[model samples]
Target: MTSSYGLTRLVLTDFRNYGSAQLTCDVRPVILTGPNGAGKTNILEAISFLSPGRGLRRAKLSEVTRNNEESKKPEKEQNSSLSWAWGIASTLSTPQGSWDIGTGLEIQEGKERRIVKIGGEILKSQTLLRDYVHVLWVTPQMDRLFQEGAATRRRFLDRLVYGLDSMHVTRVTRYEHYMRERSRLLKYGGADRHWFDALEARMSAEGVAISAARRQFIDHLLQAKAWTLGTFPQAELALAGQIESWLGAYSALETEEKFREVLKASRQQDRESGGVACGPHRSDFTVTYREKNRAAAFCSTGEQKALLISIVFAAARLQNLQGAGVPLMLLDEIVAHFDERRRAALFEEILSLKMQAWMTGTDIGLFTSFNNKVQYFRVENAMVHEKSVLIKM
Candidate 1:
């Protein structure tokens, strides 16, 4: 199920803690190793920002700049306040077309400006950016995902769904706007029932669609379970909330209407809370290891890590089959806590999936089991250096 990348280059100038660095690799699995605060994670964050949502850290554009501008050797007149260009290039090969597709980010003061260009022509809609690139990542922060609140897991699900369904981003975006307006109306001392009526209908349509897409993704995940479990533990996933219950018993349109009515009735309570109290927004994903018959959250740490890795590998393989390109994986310190056997299994599974995975760890020995064919790099003081992907074949 291996897939090749159409794009591969990260050029950064005057960005964040990084003084100035250019990173290039052969699209093979890469491992970045460095001490904490040495800016290894920052590189991953840069790549994450290239995608739709907030970067890996989800920090504001302003927070990404360095503190002492003079320390990194000022760029003379490069505009200290203007965080300069950061872009990714993808090499495309086709009989009718052969060129690079790129997306760049520029920040001035506190606002971020994104420009999407193909072979140098600027695009009108940012949506055009997704056609060329799709990114999926996991950070150390996500290690406790199952133990977190439902909202946290919902966010994770939305990110995964976004990779498979580009339109899902638009649906969620429109629904969010509707929610904001509805909340504003509620915040006011008085509001017309008609106000809630129109907006609630729109919200209901989008919300139900959003939930349906999520369920579809989970279902695909389950359908792939037999193959997924061969490399890792077997797991069963259950959807928890009104949307799931409605989906179990009603048709799509009926579920949408039922969700609409629920939203209408919850307005009074929502007004009191200042946020929607019930809906797909409140839904959760319950994961159970079928063999162990126990919730993922309560499973041993090693078991949980294996489960997470298994799901990610499954999604990558699915993407390949769907011609979604190999999902560019950004993993940070993924094997830090794993024992040798698990570490070897993780490496083997990654190779089996054949996606271009980028990982970070402090242990140089972590990647020793890999073949010399894997491309590798080292990070220090925000600078990246190319190293042999594997020390020996």
Candidate 2:
């Protein structure tokens, strides 16, 4: 029993393309199939909000609210139809019982804010979601992950890190805020040396903490049995950064001081470049295809996707083994490009892990093998209907 609990119900209101949709599921992988642009991915994005961050798209709070275009008459009717306070609520069931969880927008002092609630009680911040569930995802847009910017890769790794360290996001947010403040001051008002010292010190402390958590996560990942020899490539992981390297050789305090000095001395240089010289923000998450001894970016397109899946699987395995609980997987258009052999292998791995993954696609045939293994659903115009008999492609 790799997973003992799962999201059994999901309700959407004025979110994305759905006017109102409700789906009830069990402890099984969920497959959502429909034509393109029929709101397949929208369902995954809604489930993502149940966890943390800005869902998968990283869209702003106001952006996810629905805008009704069907109402052509009476402009006021259209305005009334559009609900700015969109919501996502669901029931998470486990061996013990079920917990009520949900999140939505609220207007406080005329400013929109995201709210998270569990068991009918609102949380102070989103970071606390870690205690209840851990969410990890892979989207078709990430097919070119290795070839793209480091920011995307950082986000992928941070989502994995959140399973182990709830405060990682907070630390990252604070560190970036201080770094931005320092940059603005350096360019416009670095005359206050005391302020500079304070910001740099805070950045150094938070940056070092963030880097340390990543290092520990990588170590724990390797130590765990996530590399449970399967069809997926056994990818090697490494952190590439000046700060990450320094932490390897020096103490935490010593490394923080070194980073602080780097920031202090790079003030003029940073101002000219409009970016810090070196920090976790600029660090890279590196992966290698152990079988081919080639970096992920250099591997074939298919191989790159395989490497990403390998990392996600390893993280899920490691999290469960460490008592952190198995994470729910969100795979959007995951099987379209995978070959039959690989596809079968991927499904086997998911079943073995007993992971309750939510997967979406445009073809019903792509998921025939999952006929009995998953809870099937077909999406039509923002509505979802569970299928008892899945027609073969």
Alpha-carbon local distance difference test for all models: 0.73, 0.85
Worst 10-residue stretch by lDDT in candidate 2?
75-84
Any runs in candidate 2 off by more than 4 Å, and if so which?
70-83, 108-110, 187-191, 390-393
User: How far is each candidate from the true structure, as Cα RMSD in Å?
Assistant: 3.3, 2.9
Tens digits of lDDT, candidate 1, 156-250:
77777776788887787788889999999998846688878999999989998988999998888778653443446876777898887898899
Where model 1 places Cα greater than 4 Å from the true spot, the runs are: 1-3, 71-128, 189-192, 226-231, 389-393
Best by lDDT: 2
Number of backbone collisions per candidate, in order? Answer: 4, 0
Question: How many clashing residue pairs, candidate 2?
Answer: 0
lDDT score, residue 248, model 2? 95
Candidate 2: clashing pairs of residues: none
TM-score per prediction, in order, is: 0.87, 0.91
